[model samples]
Target: MPKVSKHLNAANLIDQVCKCLDEIPDHRPNHCPNGIPFPNFAKSAFAMMHQKYDSLLTFDSDRADPVILHNLATMYHVQDQKVPCDTRMREVLDPIEPAQFRKPFKKLFSLIQRNKLLKAFEYQCGDLKDWYLMPVDGTGLFYSGKCRCQECCVKNKGKPNEAYYHNLLGGCIVHPDQKVVMPFAPEAIVQQDGDNKNDCEQNAIKRYLAHVKREHPHLKLVILLDGLFADNPTIELIKSYGWHFIIVAKDGNHKSLIEAMDALCDQEQLSYHKIIDEEQGTRHWFRFANDVPLNASKLTQNVNVLDYVETDSEGKRHTWCWVTDIELTKDTVEAVMRGGRCRWHIENQTFNTLKNQGYSLEHNYGHGKQHLATNLAYLTFLAFMVDQIQEMASPEFKKALKERARGVRTYLWKVITRVFLSWMLEGWDELFDALIYGIKPGRVQINTS
Candidate 1:
């Protein structure tokens, strides 16, 4: 254990976040031989996002304005220095392809794994009792009333009768102890002319699986999914990709399939039971069903099922279910239940954080007639990953955060606002000194020269 505490020391984490930005090719130079130094766009963006999440700042960049602002945030509070009024920020992001932005997501996964932040997932799924469990799902983030670009998914409305939607198929490896769910590259679901639309979730899953395998052939994962993905073809496809699955199996969705499972269970054919206690003050009773025929049709594959009933503090009884590729046993039921329940982490941890936390994922920062919407969303997610990593791994930054005592966004906004007021602070260290050493505002000279 790394002696976990509440105070967040996020500088090293900030450094890590900056490194992700470094992976991006900077066209601007530092001098004649090196050109002018590239502006710290990553830090500025992160700072802005952090403030936005804290509800302390807002900038109106309607026609690609350069200077960011805060109606309530003071000039002395500004952290990011203003750049020349060039449309370069938008131009720089405009041409960058979406595929190139996706590279950082993979880097995030590698960094978490290397730093042991993801160690909590060592064995939460039964199939890989020693490996991690990754569940894949898809979601749509941007939708527009106008036909934005060629890659847009079009839909017909009542009057205007036209719109564009952007969606991504996302996947994450989940574990009982991990607070943040690690997300993979999202496959865009778009539309095309003369075609019904672009790929749906089913096809997206197929391509995503292939991509994951091509990249991490030896990685161990047990895919968990909704009942929509419990069919034979999907199962076979998953198995072929060399991954395990724990999909939802509802009696209503698969009537014949559940009937077969019931018959087998009644015959005392390899069925078992177990009880579990969750950290969230919930109790779960699990009924394990294994090697049961998934379909009554000609094509059937034997799969494992775990039917669970949970009772929470409010005395609400919730019925849940899952089908897995792992064999059911007394030793594995607890792990199965954990993987099944952690499915909510993707929605709660990943998507919710992106929406409610500082990322403002749903907010329309830029709705370019081209790829601006999707590109901005990617940038926000990248910033979010950096924040989560800092919260989980960085110690010094965490401590400074604790002393600040406010939320991450609030503290960051104060820093940014202070910078804009032309305070004497040179770097984060001087800023921290001003905050801690009680250097009153306007009492010191900010050495911009």
Candidate 2:
């Protein structure tokens, strides 16, 4: 049995979180000074998302069990064995800015970088060295018609009572072959302090990039994005940061650009490369051109275009087109295309896992008058980062994943919740050890006599 690295185990990771969130400035009014410490409030709230509990009430119920309370103290660094009630926790945390959560994410990411765990996610090509593939996109947080708060963005579309929703522009360091994604700090798209118009994805992305610049200015990134981000301003923002981008370009959205590609194809200016594999019975093709204007404007920005198509043994074909800054040679086109196509990983593996797998990301945990909903989203994303971090580095977590259900997180979270509730864990090590080995081979037989 290999020992999990001191820097990589689950308890050590959550303890790092404890050290960060422990400094969350006290927002409670001085009139009521008997409130629980901010660490307990913050981490107890985070525990709900980490354990995949559906509601604040559900997670709060565990406070009744002394053994579970002990485990919470042992595992999550919950101070004083006291988990706050749902209402108290929400009340205490609501006023604190969601930005506070970014600290833990930066700390965790620093660990990954300093310990060389991010090497598995690196993408390199000509002139692009030690760069990570980061997929950037937006996803909807929960929405409601009746539970409106000052923070919600309204979508009326000519209706009297507008439906309110929250969204986040998220980015993650990703790889085509890996299922686990290391997420960046998520940006909440909500009404600004004094803005009259509804908030938007473009504005959220601007803030997201600002935060990325402030937090991690040195890392080289190849940003993978969808058609919505193919516009001029988004293009210029990425370029301003000196980072590279590969964005999907649809004909309907970028008519002038696609027409330019077609014109070049007619003139036979495009270079084509194909790789056919007899073992897989498939053919991969790349056609590319460089130094084309992104639009018909006289001063429009220029990009390199690469079109990819894959043909199966049955002759069925699928195609994708992208515009990027990378110089697209025969060798480089395929790697850039893979990076472009891997943008879907943010939607499939990260967001889908949060929405459907068990995190209940869209569920309304609490909609406080202040920052409850947004902070809850941050907590959920943080929980996901912890799980992803363990998947990347922890041997014990890997072992438990195999012993339980072969890396299925839903099963892993479920058994961890049940076992921690039923038994006492001195730390995460014992729990994972119990899971890696057998908890019990067989239960006692029921007697009807």
Candidate 3:
């Protein structure tokens, strides 16, 4: 099998995705002579996601233009295409399984690994070295009192009213210092059967973890998780996969574990370390105990408990506590604390950017009876992954982003879309050149011949 190219740019990445979509078998009725090919419909939908169009109606309107049609053919590789109307596009995409979209994510990650882009993400601490930190969390994508499909999870609020919502368990590779996060495939927390039981985050997490391990069995992962995942079963699952973890442990939830650590500290059996940075007017205190039991029932499941408190010149203080399989030492405790705290990036960088920064993750694009909403979310995340890759690797994109005023991403997107629509460009390099250096190609003309 041929490897994905080491020198892939945004255009080449999209082209590779087009090839992957072309391979997904279209299950539309065979007798329908007018059915759009799945790849063309998928590519068009991805274009909307790539450009951050708010609605299918707006995307369909833009797709009606001859210039847009030509661009779709040349740039995205849509084939034999009359632009499908919004309704038709939804109908076509509804039945397609969302899992199929994960292929491109895996492929792109492989390319990054092969090209040595992942080296920058390797985290180093005390005795631990060269492990990638993957933070996992869940978020609500859609919520309503009225709209819902079969997949929506319903919550009855002890009244005549019910809240229907869609939730997704998202995980991302992160670093303590880097702002960019590379999201992995997300698992939908929804109704699996017609049963009364609604799916949940913990259940979704088990599925997500299994999927991640199955997909990348050999990748050295140090899983970072929140207080919700500090339970015995989840920790056991992480251990069973031969992966390391640093999970938030709160006194309220893990009282027994906290008490055990406190007892060890009173006996002076645990290690204590402190640092005061006079220049920054901050004091750091760390305490750690090894061979600590996680809970009453799981005494055999030993873990390392580490906690830190930081005090500033104003006398305000902040504290964090975590449980990890990795041993805590004087040299390694601070790095472990940083890794544990960086788990919030899954929310701040990945979910927030998707929801607030013009990706319109919560907007109701299409809610088909089957998989349309989930599929669209997957495609949108794929677009985000591409943008993140460019942010890390593309100097031209970096230059354009730096020159963008006020650092408003939506405005930058507008400029890029306008350039894409107005000019005839060969690839992403030309697009970035135009944005960075004010170079313009001749306006694209509709070929009437």
Candidate 4:
């Protein structure tokens, strides 16, 4: 483990991100074309994502201000004398493959690892320590009736009513107690060439798993998944990468496996159970069976099955079950349960925050003829990753967040944008101080240089 910094800040992280963006090769042709620099256009798009602007029109309007222009140039490394309009931004960015945008995400992850920020994310299960819990799931980002792009997957509901939508498979490093979840590069669930079959979450997961393994081959990850991924092939794929998994094993899907486990429990062979009483008159019961085959066919591939239920005085019961490659024992059952439950953070913290909490992730920014919608989603997730990093480590960001009365992220974003436009601030620290200490910007010396 590296020595973690106590003062890691977002400004420096953004600056490093800009440097990484600078390294992406400009694939545009050199002939007579629009004069807007690719880096400037890319930076402008990234700025809109970071600010959580709902549309490109608003971002273009804000970019017209000379103060905002100066701030963009100074803060985000946009070099063009003029910001690219929305149309030109789409034109320039659409053709640039979404895979290129993934570089910055990898860069940010590397930075987090180097700074030892991942130490706080390390999850343990008895003898297992320092395992990063990566939860993978899929969600719909865009849906329209009339608008259908080449990338949109078509869903026909028997008649004239058809739906075209874009779905993505997203994974993030998550922890049960941690409020922030760091997202990885998402894989789009879109139509592919020469294939009549529509792309689904399972296919996307295969691609995403390959991508993750190719990108970070050495990182120790325990794959957390929902019931959809509790199958033989997916488990084999995970095992092939030398990774561990804790996947939801629902009764409806794994009936045979459940029956076999129940038989073992009835015989009290390879089965264990524990009961605990809480102060609030709640009784918690845990049961687990080891070396259970996943199905009738894959009898050689065994998994450890674990389940828990809590019954209150009112007779209400809450139950959960999971299957994992990890060995099931009395000492490790609770830790495994915690790891399994942390999968919700990917949906609640990452997806829900992006959708409802001011990121406007579901809003249609632009559906270009090519990869615009997917690229915009990628950029939005990148912005969310930066914010999560700041929340986890930066004291200045935490202080500014505390100063807000409502404590809503959207309001905080509005406050930051207001301060950026109204005040002659030079860096993030000065802007944060203005928000935190209520210091008038007029009193501070403005450093335009």
Tens-digit lDDT track for model 1 on 158-270?
45767777776667776778775667766666553223333366666777788778767777777878787788888998898777777888877788867876787778774
Give the worst 10-residue stretch by lDDT in candidate 4: 191-200
Candidates sorted by TM-score, best first: 2, 3, 4, 1
How well is each residue in 2-61 modelled by candidate 4, as lDDT tens digits?
Answer: 242444576877787777677767777883455766677778888888877889988878
Segments of candidate 1 deviating more than 4 angstroms:
1-88, 124-129, 157-160, 192-199, 265-270, 276-283, 406-449
Which one is best on TM-score? 2
The predicted structure with the larger TM-score, 2 or 4, is 2
lDDT of each: 0.61, 0.85, 0.82, 0.82
TM, every model: 0.76, 0.94, 0.91, 0.91
Model 3, residue pairs in steric clash = none
Q: List per-candidate RMSD values in Å.
A: 5.9, 3.3, 3.6, 3.6
Model 4, residue 9: what's the lDDT?
A: 73
**Least accurate 10 contiguous residues by lDDT in model 2:** 191-200
- Where does candidate 1 have its weakest 10-residue lDDT segment? 70-79
Residue-level error in angstroms, candidate 1, position 226: 2.5
